[model samples]
Target chain A: MIKQFPIQQFLDENGKILNKDIRSQITTELVKNFYQHCVRIRTFDRKAISLQRQGRIGTYAPFEGQEAAQVGSALALQQDDWLFPTYRDHGAAMTFGHSLRNILLFWNGRNEGCIPPEGKKIFPPAIPIATQIPHAAGAAYAEKRKGTKNAAIVYFGDGATSEGDFHEGINFASVMKAPVVLFNQNNGYAISVPINKQMSSQTIAQKALAYDIPGVRIDGNDIFVVYFETLKALERARQGQGPTLIEAVTWRYGAHTTADDPSKYRDQTESQQRRHTMDPLLRIEHFMKNEGMYDEHWINEIEEAAQAEIDLAVQEMEEFPVANPADIFDHVFAEPTWGIQKQKEEYLRLLEVNP
Target chain B: MMNTVIQTKTLTLVQAINEAMDTMLKENEQVILLGEDIGKNGGVFRATDGLQEKYGEDRVLDTPLSEAGFVGAAIGMAVNGFRPVVEIQFLGFIYPAYEQIMTHASRLRMRTMGYYTVPMVIRAPYGAGVRAPEIHCDSTEAIFTHMPGIKVVCPSNPYDAKGLLIAAIEDPDPVLFLEPMRSYRSVRDEVPDGKYIVEIGKGNRLIEGEDVTLISWGAMVPVALKAAEQMKVRGIHCDVLDLRTLYPLDHELIAESVQKTGRTVIVHEAHATGGVGNDIVSIINDTSFLFQKAPVERVTGFDTPVPYFGFEDHYLPTPKRVVHAIEKVMKY
Candidate 1:
């Protein structure tokens, strides 16, 4: 049966709740928090792009259009759960307690960017596509073995579905009943290749069926759907049911990274139209206004706070010590191999000669 | 009677591996064994036999045939505080998991700047001469030796296998533990019981001589020894060093041996082009240049894919080849 996975939603684009059951759970404070986080990460993402263009940082992967999927799913994880993010998922990482300074430093090409805060089981953003899928599964299996209540969530893109790791991770996790959630953002393109050109499979969620697990399709632009669905999936994991694959149908409104232009492959006007109709931030704003929870003064305060926070993080990142070339050799092993030591010395000699 | 008490036990290479894993599982709660058919099937070669029953399914996992998944998963488990020993069934089959091993597992420590260190072991049965067919007999330990973070290890005998596997598990870095499939059943030696470690970067000198140095590892070790024995009969005393760990290299041991002998012959079953032999030759050229009485010679397989069964004998390095290499080196 090739029945379509109905695109599940909890709020319309205009901000009215489509589900009555969630109305009680939705509070003004929760709405305010969601708006603030969305704005905060959006601010971080835009500032990062500007930094890249100004040569302040390395190439940046922006998530301006995928904030709800990042923030909502991150908000669903428990304090002790594991989060495995990709190069494009730092918005999710920040929402999950990752340091803004460290995230900035990561884009600056420092190894210090990979370190997670104490007690936060956040893996470094995997640059290799789909590699973190199995890692998240494995981490979840460790928690299950320890008989802990912890779970894991792995974030990937639409293109990652075509990777061998996606199947391997999902299949293994399914067979082992690992306590993990496979969260996929269907952002439509991998660098330049569209999803249709990449894989024949119509939906990322449908691939989960092959592994015999629950597959969900949600409006990633709608915060409530993303948050509630991820929580439901995670609850299944902690109860030993197994992993759930969530296909967050979303879009990226900018270039894949600061180095490329989106207009080369797709029409700019189409993107602008999509942004007006499907932007996650605008969708939330619509909902806040509909619920009469939207306060202009409070909203102004949030934008200002986000700007100040991002500015401080930029300062902190810039003030960090310059990356020592020796740390690269030193940390290659727990103890440097003799070969590494010799290479380090040779490098130093070469530098001295050049200088 | 007390003086006559038997302590050392003779076991095969596979038996030594099983016992070492059993000991680790018993001693440390974090040690886990995972691979295809390792659980109910006790592994394709029975190296992990009865471990699933003894340690339970939680510790001994029977993974699917996906190498990338399980290997990457093992890296994660290691990062999350579990010491996972993963098996790739065959060394040839490990290619599918190479990205996980090379890009992620090897770089985790360096990329995280030591905030995260991967403490894991990837066990693969390598080398040829057992006639196991194509895609099953790869002796490419040199590939891993080229990597910076991973410790490349190969044990030629039961004693070394057990000790090296323990050391590999205890090591804070990722280790590529290559087992000699040819010696798995053929080579039996007296192995000590309980926990022991053969340090990852030290070379073992099997025999000492003043004439020439014979360096080898894995299945080539016995061939080197036999050649040395033959040289001894011809009154050409030779020193032999088994390079247990190839990457960090026992450069000191290799240098000392080459210095004393003033000549050297490196033997291996892998193709000659970019093998570990070249690295050793360069080191000898650098350190023992003044001590050399003859040019270095290498007895290695041809620079080609390992041929199928009938031509396999000609494809692998032989004691004859090693002896020939020694003769050629001495003549130089």
Candidate 2:
């Protein structure tokens, strides 16, 4: 049954155009933009992991191998559209205009990191699997009700697809004709559990059939395919055509999180080999080079620019004021509950006694 | 003869919730409903009946069976300026979305340094009298109350349900609104027809007395009231304190009642161990220990899974149990 939705590829692993019909959509400017953002996020992700290792930040979820899936779909979204991201989606959030300094702050256990830049409809990363599905549906539905063209896109992983919220969100969006995109990155494994053990379903894309929505299976490593398909889905949603379930077949070359070790379950050598053949950034570079769209000076400039941006973000994050422990107890509600108030008071007393 | 103007008919608990959602959707552009079977089906319990038709499918959404997905999404929507009211179908089924509620919805404001807030409400039907399956009727209020950033509210009457729900919808913080499925239609009152807001964190004194103070919430409120009426015949004046908001817990009201009565009994339909009743007892012990004339007595369900239909009556904290607890406290 899964074979029926054999991964659809617009561009092959070698960066050769596989689907000539859609090649016209790939302009030189679009290609360059995709490469630039992808490189920018990739660098940011690597820096975050390094910071985590150095005890500068808390545990981090690396999106090393899933760059194409995050970058492509996030880039396709309009500025006004809503983004529901999971803990592993900071790459997508950064690409979608979330502040880098804030992102860094969030990793460092500071409350300031959770805030997105003004006017950016980026939600704080959902730690629980699949919980953002219904939220995205409701938000998109609101946009539709307000007579606006703005849609919403929610990012989740293969593990999240098994959650009930995934089904509920898709079902509601399908029934209500909500303008939202359900983007799933099928990276083979969800934490330690492989996809095969997660569910009986052969493919995540087929789950869309139950909701009676359009489901597309794409080669997530091919940036062109991911970008074009995501844009098409967003367009359909904006046009009042309802929700779309996109299964982006990709891989995660890193651990589930910094707290996890991937070698306990999966083979790491396979991931290293895939880096040369099916890498999203490398594939984009290959396409650009093959199409004569890549200039050595332009490529170098993009790399240098990405590094400088990351450096500034790191500096800004470090220069921010230290976090206050009292901030943790505030804002559970507009007015603190008695329990919270008591707990906060107790915590402060403990701090005072210790100090 | 005095001229009289007739008012609109009173609504049931379910009707009150539906009306609240309808009123909010009509008044605010951001208010939306999302849950399984909420759209064309009007919800599994029909609490959202006619909403999809009146508000259209966009406002009244029927979602897949993805609790975590929708709950987290509602948090996202709330942070992004949408007042999303999520339904969990049953209290027992909400465990999947607990992480989102506890980690994100409850803490977003603090986590974001006040830059964002999750002004959302999660509604679930709870209690054991409904004879629901093992997991369907669990009174999970304690779990939510344990969380720091969210408000937990349980209304015993239709009027309070409607008013508190409206308040919760308008509240700038996330709220957990637990509606008793068994009392959805069994309990009805002359709820105001128009919009009204009930103050959160305030307990209402249902029956003022001098002998013992009975603290209860949700389904147990009715049980406590019944028990108080019964205790009246025995010359035991039982003061019934309905804690509308479980988290904030009108400590002032409880303490005042305890000081006046000199004794207290906490009643709830959830398990006796680690339930909200224990917390109430602990609070009274901590703050009003010197004022208390007797050890706090608790009337609650047994520490076991909500039984099947055959033993539901035994499993639930009945009016008899509440009355017995009141008598025991009075004796103390």
TM-score of each: 0.98, 0.89
List clashing residue pairs in candidate 1: none
Please give the lDDT score at residue B37 for candidate 1: 94
Q: Show model 2 residue runs off by greater than 4 Å.
A: A1-3, A22-25, A192-203, A349-354, B1-26, B33-81, B86-100, B128-137, B181-189
Task: Estimate the lDDT of model 2.
Answer: 0.86
Q: What is the TM-score of chain B alone in each candidate?
A: 0.97, 0.96
Off by over 4 Å in 1: A1-3, A349-355, B1-6
Query: Could you tell me the lDDT of residue B179 within candidate 2?
Result: 93
Return the interface RMSD of the candidates, in order shown, one decimal each. 0.7, 2.7
lDDT of 2 by residue, B189-280 (tens): 88767677888888899988889888998888888888888889988888789999997888889888888888988988888888888878
Cα deviation at B46, candidate 2, in Å, is 6.2
Q: Score the docking of each candidate (DockQ).
A: 0.87, 0.52
